[model samples]
Target: MTYLVTGGSKMGKSTWAEDLALELAKDGPVHYIATFKPVDAEDALVIARHKKARAGRNFAVTEKHQGLEAVVIPPGAVVMLEDLPNLLANEVFDDGDVSSILPGLKFLKALAEHFIIVTNEVGSDGTVYDALTGNYVEALSFLNRQAACLSDVVVEVVCGFPQMIKGDGP
Candidate 1:
């Protein structure tokens, strides 16, 4: 089963995903697929925070900062992908506009492993933006939509609380 957890920045999405992964680890091994790049001090701190939070757990960590398409994941292992917005940022857009978002949609679908993905929901504020910023917002929105469509369960975390947007088993 695939689960998608989405919320804006500082919205506790990763915390929730980590909690779920820990719970799943009680039964078996949990694989964490980290995609964040530690480009600066702040990012490095964020990575450290995650590491500390998940320290000494029954899990295997695989950090994939780029080229996630070829990664092989184990079956029945709960996987959590932290905030995919950064991955979408690397795409080259058309017309020099870069507004399109078909590649991300395809990546999420091809991951035939049991896992949960965490992403930011950036379009909820409904704020108007310039061309470049607007394209990014649109891309995040599109990515979330595709995740929702492909996910077996959809969860929205608010104020550190998890609310199920979709559930398991028909």
Candidate 2:
């Protein structure tokens, strides 16, 4: 089962995704792939908050800044990708590559029996962007669409509500 959870920031997508991962994991092992790499104090705070939330949750968390294809995940693991947008940023901006994201997704999708992916909702607000930001927005949209295609369940979180966008809900 692959679940793609998406929403704007602070919409409780991560919480809902965590619950769904626990439900799917049952007695099995659950791995969390944290893709956000902090660059400043605010980002550090965000990381801290996420750590606090996951504390004692039985999640074997790995901080992966980039290269999702290189992560060594156990077979049949119920894996939750903390989010996707940052991973795309890391791939394009940090690693100077964008071609591997989809193949990486396919690899993870095949390796894990249950995959819970969380991504952001963007390009919805009527705000024009500059070239770099515009390219990022376009790339992220591509990633989200590809993820939705690969997912068995696609959910959109709105104001903490998990609204089903595709497939069956938990």
Candidate 3:
């Protein structure tokens, strides 16, 4: 079961995805694939908060910021990808390309029986931006669409409430 959970920043998507993955992994191992590579103080703080939140949850944390294909996930593992936007950003900034993200997403889907992916909902506010920001938004939008199409369950979190856009509600 591939589930895609998307929302704006701080909208409870991560919390919901974590809870779902824990529930699904009651009988198996839960692999928490954290995509963010903390490069600044703020990033480190956010990562720390997430670590605290998942403390004692028995999640096998795999901090892979790039090369998702290299991550060795156990068979039939319940995997939760914390967020996709950071991964995209890393790829974009590192290589000035976002096309590689689609293949990575496919690899992750194939690696687990139950995959829970968290990503951001960009450009919904209709705000104009600079050239680079615009490119990032376009790329993220495309990736989100692809994920939603492939996902068995697609949820949009708004104001801490999950609105099911595809599949049955959990």
**lDDT against the true structure, each candidate:** 0.70, 0.90, 0.88
Can you write out model 3's per-residue Cα lDDT over 77-101, one digit (the tens) per residue? 8998877898898888878346667
Return whichever of 1 and 3 wins on TM-score: 3
**How good is model 2 by TM-score?**
0.96
Candidate 3: give the clashing pairs: none
Q: Candidate 2 residues 1-170, lDDT tens each?
A: 89999999999999899988988899766799999989999999989998998887879898987778898998999999988998988887786468887888898999999999999999999889999999999999989999999999999999989999999998
The weakest ten consecutive residues by lDDT in model 2 span: 92-101
Which pairs of residues collide in model 2? none
Span of 10 residues, lowest total lDDT, candidate 1? 92-101
Stretches off by above 4 angstroms in model 1 are 92-113, 168-170
TM-score per prediction, in order, is: 0.81, 0.96, 0.95
Model 3 TM-score on a 0 to 1 scale? 0.95
Cα lDDT tens digits for candidate 1, 1-170: 77888876787988788878777566676777776667699989988987887888766788765556545665445667765786666443322222333343345446534667888878778789999889788877877887788788898888888888888521
Better of 1 and 2 by TM-score: 2
| Model 3 CA deviation exceeding 4 Å by range | none
